[model samples]
Target: MPFAGFYAAAPFAWRVSHLASDFAMAWFKGWSQKDQRRSRTVLLSGVAGLAFIGVTMKRVPPGHVGLIEDWRGQLLPGMYDDSGTHWVLPIVQHPVSVRVYPVKKKLVKEFTTKDGKPVEVMLQMKMAPKIYYVPEIYLRFGRDYGRSFLEQEGAIDVNSVVSQHTFDELVGDNADTEDIVDEIVSRIEDAAFFHKIKLRDPNIVFRDPNADDDEGP
Candidate 1:
């Protein structure tokens, strides 16, 4: 009779054990889902915080102009001058530095003068973009106006002017090289004025063709 009673209770005991196991598994699954949600929220919040900081802070150095370009690489209309610190959207916009201070460049070229003699002339000049026309300069020349416009175009103008004068007229005993320099400076200043560039205080030197030379003026 005792053995019979034990067999009858075994099935009931197995059902109770199975129910308890299912309850435990369901509770654990619910707790895991909650943890996953909390982790995701924290990760998204961190990314958003970083993006906000990046957009709010910007710096522009002294003696420079800050030009802003959009993500599509288009320059904005506004110009920033004499800057120390600035603010803009970091990812959507970028800051470009343009030096407003006077920039110097030297040009040395061999030209055949009106008398057919090859003369080497060296010239130096100081130039800068007008403050009020910074935006125009940026629009017309981009970031390399100093080299592309001033140096390259200036060289061509210098050669054209020198070709009109003979070697004797450039450096002879009665030659006033200063007058030539002044003329060249005036022409450059006039040409660049429309483009928002200023040329100042040009100085010219004539190098001896017989001397050993390796570089320009």
Candidate 2:
């Protein structure tokens, strides 16, 4: 009888142990589901936030051109007091480049050579916008003039460069026509003083000449 009771108690203990394990496993599964749901929600929210930020960045669209940098190192639409990227009211402003130019010029003018003979002079100068002159040049000439700062100015830009004294200065054989031109250029540069243009080295090509016939004026 005691042996029979022992066998019967073994089955009872096994059933209780199995039931306890089942209950623990079910509770564990419930907890896991809650944590998984929370993690998924957090991940989705992060993705959405990143997407929103990317869209905003793309939408920034460049604003009104507070300043523009040209190929010649000149700024257009006018020069700026400061340099680097700038910010402005949205839709109120933006920047754009309208013109770009190389660093070279061809000029023609009439003047008295050293011998007091009237002659036509031609010049070819290789230049670029001075890093310093952009602001003033843009303000005065606007973007168009700033684009080809020399072109817009042209020869007439220095209307009085060849002064009455220019002829006299060349008459005494003390100064050559080229030297006089240099003086005129110096004065023009001094007067305008636009920082945008660089009057680098100049090459003189005598385009044409009318002999004085060796006759005294």
By lDDT, who's the top model here?
1
RMSD of every prediction? 18.3, 22.5
Q: Write down the TM-score of every candidate.
A: 0.67, 0.38
Q: Name the 10 consecutive residues with the lowest summed lDDT in model 1.
A: 207-216
User: What tens-digit string does per-residue lDDT give for candidate 2 at 103-181?
Assistant: 5567666755444446455656665444445455556666544335444453543334444444445433554756656
Flag clash pairs in model 1.
none
**Candidate 2's error at 76, in angstroms?**
12
* Candidate 2's TM-score: 0.38
Model 2: number of clashes? 11
Q: What's the true lDDT of residue 24 in model 2?
A: 56
lDDT of 1 by residue, 44-103 (tens): 799788888767666677888988888998878777766456667777888888888998
lDDT of 1 at 192: 87
**Residue 95 local lDDT, model 1:** 88
